[model samples]
Target: MVLIVLGFIIFIAINVVVKNNPVAAKFAGAGRILALVFILLGISTACVKQIDAGEIGVKSLFGSIQNDIMGSGLHFINPLLDVKKLDVKTQNYTMSGVNDEGNKAGDDAIKVLTSDGLEVTIDLTVLYRVVGADAPRLLRETGEDYRDKIVRPITRTKIRDNAVYYQAVDLFGSKRDEFQQRIYKSIEDDF
Candidate 1:
């Protein structure tokens, strides 16, 4: 906007203010060309957006989220729109028994009470990603901190909920697959 305004000011000063000066009249054409260049440069920069690989763009216009998303590439869009880039590549979150292994400094593994009243400590790693088509809604509803606010709490809760259905020994050996499948199904539905 500043560029466009400055361009117009230059054009007016060259053509109107200096029209009567014989010495300035010789350079008026060059000043006019420079003014047009500034106007074009501002418009081009404002309308073009580039999204990096493994990322998607969520566009919002005048603070309202748009339903559509932009994939990795250059896009021509409205000058007034704001774009937030989100990575679509696979992401991993871990809860581990060892300190420094999980996202937190302490032992972050899940502890749950089994049906037989035994305490079970489980180390879990969850892999997830954002879908391009839902990026706008996800951004609007969850914001950028979806990892802590949404993913972590929900995963821990669902695992604990499913753990009580099996004995501690079964969760570690025989019914381990079943327990994992049940937890996955519940979390998938909620997500």
Candidate 2:
């Protein structure tokens, strides 16, 4: 955009200013050429988008999100459109009791109350990925930082919601797999 603006300024100056100055009049054509170069360069840069492997692009124009997406490759698009690249590969998120082991600082483990009225600390690791076809809707509704706005909160809530179905000791021992499976189903449905 700046380049295009600068190019227009130079073009106007050459036509209006150079015509009056006989000494610099010889360079009028050269100035117009330079301006054209800048404009073309600006247009090319803005129209071409390159998406890397395992990534998708969501486009928005004038603050309105577009439904159609851009796959991994070069795409020619509107110069005014804004493109946000998102990774589509499997992503890992952890909420652990140990510092520096989770996505956030400090102990980010989930605390859930069991049916027996016991408080349990859970270190959770979730593996997930963005659906390429749903990237546009995801961006439109949740913006780019969906992990903080959607994933983390929803995951913790589902875990806590299902934890009450079992006793605290069972969650860590005999019924651990059942507890995990229940939460997994809950989270999957929500997502």
Query: Which numbered prediction scores highest in lDDT against the true structure?
Result: 2
TM-scores of the candidates are 0.76, 0.90
Query: Cα lDDT of model 1 overall?
Result: 0.90
Q: 1-191, model 2: which lDDT tens digit per residue? A: 88888899999999888878889999999999999999999888899999999999989999898999999999999999999999999998999999999999999999999999999999999988999999989988999999998889989999999999999889989999999899899999988
Evaluate all candidate structures by whole-model CA lDDT and list the values in order.
0.90, 0.93
What would the per-residue lDDT of candidate 1 be over residues 21-43, giving only the tens digit for each residue? Answer: 87887788899899999888878
The Cα error of candidate 2 at residue 191, in Å, is 0.4
